[model samples]
Target: MGSVVEHKRTDKRTGKTVTQYRAHIRRVGFGSRSKVFATKREALDWIRNNESDNALTKRASAGGKTLASLIEDFIAAGVCQYASQAHLAYWCDQLGNKLVSEITHGDINGALLSLRTRGGRRFTPDGIKPSGKPLTPATINRYAAALSAVFNFAQAHGVIDAHPMKGGKVKKLKEGPGRQRILTPEEETRLLETARAARWDGMYLFVLMLLTTAARKSEVLNLRWRDLDLGRGIAVLGKTKNGAARALPLVAEVRKGLAELSKVRPINSDFVFYDPKQPGRPKNVDTAWQFVRERAGLNDSDDPVHRVVLHTTRHTGVTKIIRNGANLAQAALISGHKTLAMLKRYEHLAADDVLQLAEHALGKVGTGSSKG
Candidate 1:
């Protein structure tokens, strides 16, 4: 139901009264928006149009919103803004012309199949070419997630009645274990030497932080100078992957490196690992990482598990922290993981070479259990 009210106002200079009509309505989950008009008839017309318009708009928009329109909304809202929105182009070609509301789980599966076969591209310095590697199930799930998010956003904004994802029905790609490469002490020494030899700003410090703290690349990169408590030897990471705040221990090596880097660090910038060129933002470490890994001769592995990348430092760090005697709860706090299940995934990645520690523990238990 809608109601109209005539608002009366008196002129300051002239002894005259002004009348205005305002109409307001509430449409349950569809939400509320109102319009005011000079004439009562105009307000009544707007109320009539808006009330009926919501219903008609829902039908027309749901029926006529093509996949291309969804992508447009996705970009506008910065859903997949990273990769310059090119990663989603394959989906645009497959489902761009189809209506969003009518798109089915079968359609999504079909698109995933197309990607796995020959529906995507690979870019080179010269131009675009057919992608050699087929899309992984994990990658396909990511695309499905992005698409589901588009629908979810629509539903949240009252553009659609409900999202079409319907839980995990549309997202059905089983993924195997994630990457699991731990760097040996020898490799660590060599990699650090290589990074220092290359002479890039923040490279050495960033590497040391990941190796020492088991912090993600994003968490390390997103750190501000203010986040550090130099006196207390702790770094507060507020923008962690789990979206919670945690304090990262600043080890002797990381603390020493930070002290040296702080001398040359930009005082104007807040970031601890900020780019010299763009002091406000984190330095782009990908190119430097690839270069250093290639220089150290560690980039030829076929399996992602064997790949010695920047994130390998985090894995190695976590495993080392646990091996040196931190429990799962301590590891989770250091790594900023929200759950033990996530730690279990890491445990699966890392080989258990500490069986001797378990034996030693059993020996202690047996000694303690002895009856005199």
Candidate 2:
């Protein structure tokens, strides 16, 4: 039921007279708030629309949740089983402040766009480059996913009728260039020699792991000694990105590298790669790796590989495997990517070469029919 009441009142200081109509509407879950109008007809119209919006808000509130409340609940549940707390915290910070009723698809799009605008940045601990760097599209995609998950979770929990994010589209930015810079045979030898000559103990082994397994630097650092099954010739990766446990076989050189690491490995820490200076701290070899890159004499001011960091090794490995005739599925599995499409991006061949290979495989070798 709804009612419109007319009233006359006087202003306090100015003492001006006023006549107004106040619409009183009954909400299913929330109490009424007075809406003022100039006339009875306008007040009635106001009540009609207010009633509809109030009903939606009431239903959402009935389950003891609001949009904002649901997001906090999702974060508090600690549902990101495989994600680092810092990662989850980042998403929480991004979306936690908005009231559910106030959020729109535009807000979600803006957040992703902001991430794209900033390249990628790393923490220095010394407060040097506080902004770090702009983030990659892949990284931005992860944040978008997390945001989507939160909104979806809210809808499922009855906090909202539909996820604003589910039907919405985000303009995906382009993926960054692959870190794969295939080392020439001579360059590969020189890089290894340089790593061997490094003052660091595990530098040689780190280089070997990169060349053999194509494991990302972070993934390699996260590896535990127990993850290795030397007899089976496989290294079980229990913790990598994408929340899947994968097994990587040891190449001949990888096997020898692990054997060497076993001799000098510390019995206390569980890590296969640990730092000596930061004892018990798992090796974060990026800084040491930069030094190795410089010593190799391959560095230049304009080279993309200069900013390549250590993940380039993983990229290099994947490229070499594909070049050596490994199947896409095999490379995807070894690289721990969720899709075959991602593996295709790692192969650095020219567009013509791709067409040529497709034609040859499809029995249309020299013909342009493959493109068609």
Candidate 3:
């Protein structure tokens, strides 16, 4: 049982009316009632609401979870199954401090804006500094996407009422046009002959794999004999950037390179490209590559043609396939890109292709003649 009573009194110091509520709280023994409020309405409301023990318990116990708890739950669950564990740690660092209820759309926007302002540095172990460059739209969009995944999980579990990133759109910046760089037949012959004559151990095979199979440096370097099916002309990539496994078709030159590498592979190691000095580790050609570049008179790092890092081999492969008149869909599949948009970024027509088009359009014989 509860009783609500109010008394109007004057403060001796201030000489002002002080309205207070005194209630007879049953659970406690104090005179006849335990009084504790400055207003009669507030006292009555407390008396009515506190009458149910279950209601008090429900109010106190509900909504008790915090942002940190939710992030831990996400990490422990299957979220890190395919994605890098470091990425999970990064998300926790960025968004884990705020209370779940306190996070708003504006907070997410501020985080993304911060990323754009620090463009050059990756979200690595080292911190990102503000590059003072304008934010790229693609980068901003990726941040929005990563945030959406976390918030979507939060919403599904009732940690958030609705995802802050839900229905939010990011404006993408116009991408700069790609400059195509494809070697001509003469250049290709020269490059291949130079590779053969250079007589560097496995350098010939590495170049052949780049020009023929179009395998990325990481993929080619990490290639294991178990993943290769020479009979089927397939190289199975166990983990790819798209978070899926893919297979790359092997070409004749790629097969020849693999055959050569097979004779040189160590007995204990299964890596198709293992270095003898490193034993188990993939051969690192970084320093040796610079040496070769200098010897080949291709040391100008600033020149796009000479800027041919190890990755350029894969680029050459894609350009070759595209210049051979492969459709966008086929090229995308071959490259393991999730969409045609990414394939378009790698597409380069050879200079010979442009010359061929010009000859066809202008009619080579008539264009050469003055009709005197």
Best by TM-score: 1
* Candidate 2 structure quality by residue, lDDT tens digits, 1-372: 688889999977889998999888765556444667888899988777766774646654544444456656776875543444444466556665666645668877876776677565555646435355566666777776676677666766656555667643555556667454556667678788999988887888878887788887777777788899988888998766776779877888878878877887776777888877665788767667777888886564444534445666777778777777788898887888888987877666423357667655776545766543
- Clash pairs for candidate 1: none
TM-score of each: 0.71, 0.67, 0.57
Give per-residue CA lDDT, model 3, range 272-354, as digits (tens): 87777776888766655565555555444654344656566667778778888887787767776778887766644454577
lDDT per residue, candidate 1, 81-200, as tens digits? 222355567678888998776777788878777766764465565678776667677667777766776777777766565556785656567886777788888888878877886658
Q: Assess candidate 2 and give its lDDT.
A: 0.70
Supply candidate 2's per-residue lDDT for 167.
Answer: 40
lDDT per model, in order? Answer: 0.75, 0.70, 0.64
- Model 2, runs deviating above 4 Å: 1-93, 99-102, 116-120, 128-139, 149-161, 176-180, 277-281, 301-307, 348-372
**Candidate 3 deviant stretches above 4 angstroms:** 1-93, 99-103, 122-162, 169-173, 178-204, 243-245, 260-271, 274-310, 346-355, 358-372
Error of 1 at 208 (Å): 0.8
Clashes of each: 0, 9, 0
Show the lowest summed lDDT stretch of 10 residues, model 1: 78-87
Error of 1 at 252 (Å): 3.1
Model 3, residue 228: C-alpha shift (Å): 0.4
